[model samples]
Target: MSTQVLSPPVAAVRLEQVTKRYGSGPAAVTALRGIDLALPRGAFTAVMGPSGSGKSTFLHCAAGLDQPTSGSVWLGDTDISRLKPRALTVFRRDHVGFVFQAYNLLPALSVEQNITLPLLLAGRGADPGWLDFVTGAVGLADLRGRRPSELSGGQQQRVAIARALVTRPDAVFADEPTGALDSRTGRQVLELLRRTAEELGQTVVMVTHDPIAASYADRVLFLADGAFVGHLDRPSAQQVADHMTHLGEW
Candidate 1:
């Protein structure tokens, strides 16, 4: 293990024997195959896998967006697999946040409104201090009045990130967060995500295919056939590429 792996995480997320499948018997395809992994608190972690590696399945399970076929997915102390629908929504709203390749901001809402929309839907109020911190942290203070259409792709993604951070949830799950941006813009977003974990003690788990994106993570996990094949820590893009090449996926 690298020293990065030995370093204590500020917050921790765990999965035990997590598996997911569709259909039944010969028709059933196992998306995840009893994979177990831990995401340390306040750590920026990225996941990478080839086209059909079950990476998306793992992300959905981690965020409680989809139920695993068996096993447990634990966010902090909450075993998300067991929550009822209503309870699950409440739990996710209060403890988990998300970002994706799509910005997913409402077209009609201003940046501020979009960022706080989740809290409003939960019937909860935002913490004023945390709001200030998130907007400032994402450098979106001046753009809060604008709608998604008025902003660039990078800015729209920043809003999505701000919304994800606004709740100050225990962990944030980002799937292909920078996939739509140009390389330079992607780097900016990656840097901001890292800053959120490092400066504010936010825990982040991101799923990405781009080696440059994974390099920003404190640690990186590689998936193959719905299982964790290996991991890299404090990696450079070149290093990840080299490893991926050897893994027969590059």
Candidate 2:
């Protein structure tokens, strides 16, 4: 009998020579400039850039929230760039997780209901074990029956984080996830996000202008003029701030 071997999982996200344009001909505004990026499974990356530097555009394109004008995007070898609108919607629902600054939970729903909304929307039954695990992990075990209105900002964001992780998607895209919180509460959310990547084997890509927020990531990728300019590993807030200072008016 022959022995069989299995290869490591594919990259959680990959971008190849991707570009985005807002218009055509002379009126065109380019957002991404032939960008190539690969984010490994279970890793956490933060993207930072000055205003108008295409930080949001990069996150949108990479996470399948928006399409690029040229080049390809792959979520684990599936060419999401080529997916039709409806197919893309389904694919994103199944494979991608999102955490936004707004904490978009339903006021009428309890914490547990809000967290399981994605799975419900996808018409899938929640796994009891996974639900319990995520709720506990995010420190919401005791608040499952409470509504979002009853929680503190930090706790509400914790609910959002739990919701994002409930599906175990291939990657989570966070857009200024801490922008709306106070410093202490924001730090708590960031710590939970870091724990998600480090402990749960999930991949995350976040976009933020704050160096303190970027400091939570395993790697920091700096973008300027819609292109990758530099990167740092295990970065400090001071170092990230210094790099941004050199980039001018972010």
Candidate 3:
């Protein structure tokens, strides 16, 4: 296999001419159309698009949760898209964390247990300092003993965030993390996600439909029909809304 040389600046996450198609020939539905992206270290980026615009596909491919049909995905020095299944699994377990629209916590597990699930699954125990820091950062220190059933929607999402950060991942992929919560709680979760990127020097790529949520990111990348068409830095909520609206209307 020919080696692909990655860039020297060391982006925490990136995609180069990546594409994904659901079928072959005339039946094929191209989800992504040879897109490129670079997510800098310690930055928070939001991905915005309407439904079926490949927002989720991009995030999944970047996170190694799914493979692209062609091109490359680089995580730090490694081309995660090229790793074999076991290696990819290890890389994702060791370096990548993810947040989804659903809390997806084990209902039987307490907040603390749920937070440590990934680590435990990898045959590692929790680190007290990381546990303390993430839980405290998410303002869930007192709720560790509580189960998912007992927490509010926002609180559960905070637990999910804590779980994602417990391993100090190189980067995180979050898809509609605040979608399941109300506006007030959603803002709180977004703030915590922002803090995670800023204070911890972690990279984050989030897919969000809400411009308010997108505004929390340091940069916003807008997509239409599975391509990277535009970007904005330090975008305001209004700016994000305007850009997304124009993309939809285009």
RMSD of every candidate to native, in Å, equals: 4.7, 2.0, 4.3
Candidate 3, run of 10 with poorest lDDT: 241-250
Ranking by lDDT: 2, 3, 1
Candidate 3 wrong stretches, greater than 4 Å: 1-8
Best by lDDT: 2
Tell me how far the alpha carbon of residue 235 in candidate 2 is from the true structure, in angstroms, after superposition: 0.9
lDDT of 1 by residue, 156-232 (tens): 99999999888778899999999999989999999999999999889999999889899999999998888888999
lDDT of 1: 0.90
Q: Which lDDT tens digits does candidate 3 get at residues 23-58?
A: 899999999999988888999999999889999999
Clashes of 1: 1
TM-scores, all models, native as reference? 0.94, 0.95, 0.94
Q: After TM-score superposition, what is the CA distance of residue 47 in candidate 3 from its true location, in Å? A: 0.4
- Model 2 ranges with Cα > 4 A deviation: 1-9
- Return the top candidate by TM-score: 2
